[model samples]
Target chain A: MKDIIIRGATIRRELFFFLLSFIIAFGMNLYAIITFKTLWAELLTQLPFLILVTLVIYLIILLARIVFLGINKLLRIKKNKSSV
Target chain B: MNSPYKSRRAFIKKTIIGSTVLMSYPWLEALANESAISMSAANKVRVGIIGTGSRGQGLLYNLLAIETSHNIEIAAICDNYEPNYQKAIELTHGKAKAFYDYRELLDIKDIDAIVIATPLHQHAHIAIDAMNADKQVFCEKSMARTLADTKRMANTHYETGKILQIGHQRLFDKKYLDAIDYVRSGKIGNVTQIRAYWHRNNDWRRPVPEGKPELERKINWRLYKEYSCGLMTELASHQIQVANWVKDAQAVSVIGVGGINYWKDGREVYDNVALIYSYADGTQFIYDSMTSNRFYGLEEQILGDKGTFELEQNKMYSENPPQPAGILQLVNNIEKNIFEKIPIGGATWIPETALEYKGEYITGDFDVNETGISLEVFVDSVRRGKPTPGLFEQGYHASVWTLLGQQAMETQQKIYLPEELKI
Candidate 1:
């Protein structure tokens, strides 16, 4: 029995990822805005910088995930049986 | 092995560079220095008072005293009610011109700012007009009656780039500032829950002149749904504002129950309201406002895993258990079956103080009154020509949350902050 090799770039998956990222990013931005009481206009002015930072963080997080996954595979540590 | 090491090194370098770049951003520098810009007083800031009711008169008194320290003058006064207008004029010692219409006062060319202490419903319109007239505004809290009105007032403030200070005095209180600092510094740990309540025994009504059933509602506008939200908007706002400040987050949803169980004297608003407002992080602000009981006068308790902050008392209690007194320990042990056969007889058991005193006053002796500090800040901000950052948002959140809580009570369901006003 072979596992199906599914591409990660499917439209549905892409959309889901985009929504998830947006929701997380926007939620954080909203919190900062509420907490600091920064005007929306001021926030929008910093959007470019904020977007860059978000992308950098996302990339770093993705790299860390890949690193952890690789390390897990090397250890041959079975995932908890209950999860499957 | 080399590739992984290189990857790790690259990650660390990127993080350092990213942080440096973020720190060097000019906008952040601007934010830091935003309120530091000061102005030399060319002359006095000519101020106008609108709505000369009890709240209006009280603010007028503060403003009058503030004039001695700050460069401000009461240039004009306005009120719909004749008696109030006359009373405000008397306070000014006939220095300020009286007007029946607020628009007439706004038309005064020399007026630099307007202090609006009108009923909750009238706040938006007066503030908007004043801002349009290039006048700085200090409007009383529960900023406006409706969501749209509150949004409009804030939008107008942003558009005009005018100094718009909502009358939430706690923002300027040294004690509150220090207490909030303590919370933010994680001294009390993450605030998981906040409980606030304001209780009073009176019916919250102002006596009207006889032979005026129509004027009863007008005089006691706080009891009417169209004008005010009774205890929620009137009293709960201050505590709710404090709760938001402690959590550093706005409530995402609110579930409430309220009733006109007592003092039903033809009033439209509820006499009692209990609301649980949940923030995005699942922290809840449990708030209650009642008119029939004065037992628990007022309090805002910020509860965390490490400790609890009682804002009313300005005290903190540690979560760590205290060492039990020897006699109390003996009594407890006997009760728990530790000494089942031992005879334990007592005259009446006196309750011991549960927690030891770890909470200390965050404020110093020279701390100014909250309202006075608020006025000083407002006057200073007006002089500087820069509106204080976060002031509008504080008022906006408190107002929006109060209205949301009211909606929850009226509908008997949980109500969320509207998506449009989420930020």
Candidate 2:
């Protein structure tokens, strides 16, 4: 049951990051369309570009998450040594 | 044996030339005439300009631009105002004979045609005199200040048998011509309504040269009732002409309301106006002009049953727009080896409102100088010794209807076009 809870939480965290990345990609595309005075309907035609941008953002987030976890682990080790 | 490459090349060249000729306006047909191309002193059309104000100078610039290509000459120029007269003489590099009075300029028998760019009230008089003097007249738009003068001008054109081309430049614009063609070809499926507006945020006033209070009326004649019909004739006339041309019918009646809601600087004309002109076929041309807000700068929104044309923007929106090929759609087609609709956006993703479809351009090449084209065509007509068919009637009706709209606003009643006014 504990393993199941951890797996579910992991999935939720991944889903959150993916959704954030997608929203950012959508916003950037929307801004570009508006700036160019193009139709809002262009968003549908730019599906591939949107998906590519979202994946690129997600990869960057994932890399940042790993770096943040590593930094947190190092900080915790330093705190324990100081407490000792 | 016949060379296939040569035949193919010949065929392509012929097709291009044929399509260009087909797309061109009827008056522009003169450009292809052999007589028009042969440039000589005898064939050159000598043009006299009666007004050297802003509009007159604009026409002069266009004429100068096309002088060499069209075999035209600025024979003489006349203006009562000192500044404009001096400026016009400088524009022609002292080539055109300058005159203080228009009659003296008209007296020059060698001047084949005269362009009238004077104030609204002066159009009929100058045009009539020029035509009577045996010179073809190319007068600026909104034919005249009064309906009687407008009618008289048309009558003079008819009686003299001289070319009287009005400055409705849209008739010569390729975008307008293409859009109108679409309307006529049932591409738009019967235009139901047309909404046109011209808006600006300026006070519509010109400077009076500091202490020269007397020159206000002379310089800014458009603001006064005696010299102009204000926005109706100055701005609305062009759009009304477009609406009439699109419907191929004049406004049978008009009901309007106007007031000096803003810019209350003792100007006789209204600062804002809203008018609805009804056609015989139940079509309505909704028109308005204002000098207070300019959010919607200007456009002729021609709405039909199947489509809509925003002429100023050069776009046409269809009721049933074609779906463009997206990446997912292309991938789906390749995977399935067949084309089929795929529901990409699910129920939650679907938009609540109607889809905002971006319409296609009316034509790719739309950066045309319509004023130049109109003047070139007018010069051609003068050379041909004939007026362009239907051009005079279009200008006449636009002016008459514009005056009728003014009357409606003044009386606060639906004004119908009188039988006698329907030339």
Candidate 3:
């Protein structure tokens, strides 16, 4: 199972993955909106906070990815230095 | 595979990360424990609030907000603090008489229930007295500042026929309630351990009073251990209660380390503390409170085998990807979307072209509220005499959170629940 692993995935495929997730999420959101009357009201009322949360979550994911990549690079450099 | 120093650094980072993830579990943890079963009823149960301070005010606010908080009315208000007493009177539109002594407040004619939101030391005495006085009571968290007091309080609660609810309100929050369902439903798998934390900046900001020596300390009693349990009662108890709610079990034993590193203003309670509680099921609930930082506001986490739910900053959410993105998925999305509109309808009807992917973030507010939901339910239970999600045991459970921490601090050794202690 460990040998069966694959870490590298390309950008388009990532987009495809994102789209798939978003679809599932949106569908669930729609379902929630239908079932819960308050969701509709909240979307209308607390729209600003809603937008802010979305922006923040987006930034977080981006920042997290950058930091993760940076850390990975730092580890690689440290490894090379130790080898030398 | 790794260098010695590198491994050491990695180990330290991993340890920190692991602890962090553990601490993150209870934020959306134990959905307010749902035991909304019926209790035998009595009509016209009048309720009074002692220590009409912040908590008293907050409860009043909740009571007013709740749609159907039944026949019970605030018969009286008591507070050593004149401002709080006056405020409650104003909130009640002066409908309720203000009393300086809680004894007077508790003795209000025909009063059947009392809300004791006074300082920690007063909790055991006031609650036991009120119960003995034949009134149902809701005392604030960290039931008592002392183990002796807790033993007495618990005993009194059991001995008395009157209902006693402790002011551990998270048992009422909807997010916690929903999360508990997930936990019980085994969504996050079998919950073995839970963690909680409360981090805040500023020096407990209890105002340094001018000239009024005795009264201010008596009223703003949380700053001193003689009258209060310090942060153990004031802050840690809140998170500890949350851990209890998450575990759905009373703490069996606890060990903790506490240090008053931040606030140096003649306070006895540890300014920073960490406590670990064990349950009968071999589960552990851990808590930490540090006043020097608000890097993390407030949250608790319940951990299970499959995944962990992160309830933090009042939003109960979960994140786990044992495999962040499977190989096929990673290729299908990562490769194709960046390359072309290449409909990868190979072998499987993968809707690659159909949906556009979001890389930055596709986000929405998960309406997982923590505080308000429970407050509403508590009020509804009182008003309609309907089954309440958070009832008497929640109070006891919360008290146990405080007591466990207190004992750990006192003995410098782990404290265990009494043999009789049970949910």
Q: Where does model 3 sit among the CAPRI classes?
A: incorrect
TM-score of every prediction relative to native: 0.70, 0.78, 0.63
Model 1, span B1-423: residue lDDT tens: 132222332332333243433223222222223342223366578889999999899988877865744557888999988789889989999999999999999998878889998888999999999999999999899799988888898889889999778888776454565566667667789889999999999988888888877788779999998999888889999988988978778888999999999997889999999999999999999999898999999998989888887777767677874443332333345467854554477645556756545666554432345565566567766776778777778888998998888889999998988878754
Judge the docking of candidate 2 as incorrect, acceptable, medium or high: incorrect
Model number with the top TM-score: 2
Name the runs in model 2 displaced over 4 angstroms. A1-84, B1-25, B28-36, B324-355
lDDT of each: 0.76, 0.86, 0.63
Better of 1 and 3 by lDDT: 1
Give me the overall lDDT of model 1: 0.76
Per model, the share of native interface contacts recovered reads 0.00, 0.04, 0.00
For every model in order, what is the number of clashing pairs? 0, 0, 34
Better candidate number, 1 or 3, judged by TM-score: 1
Task: Give the distance in Å from residue B351's predicted Cα in candidate 1 to where it truly belongs.
Answer: 12
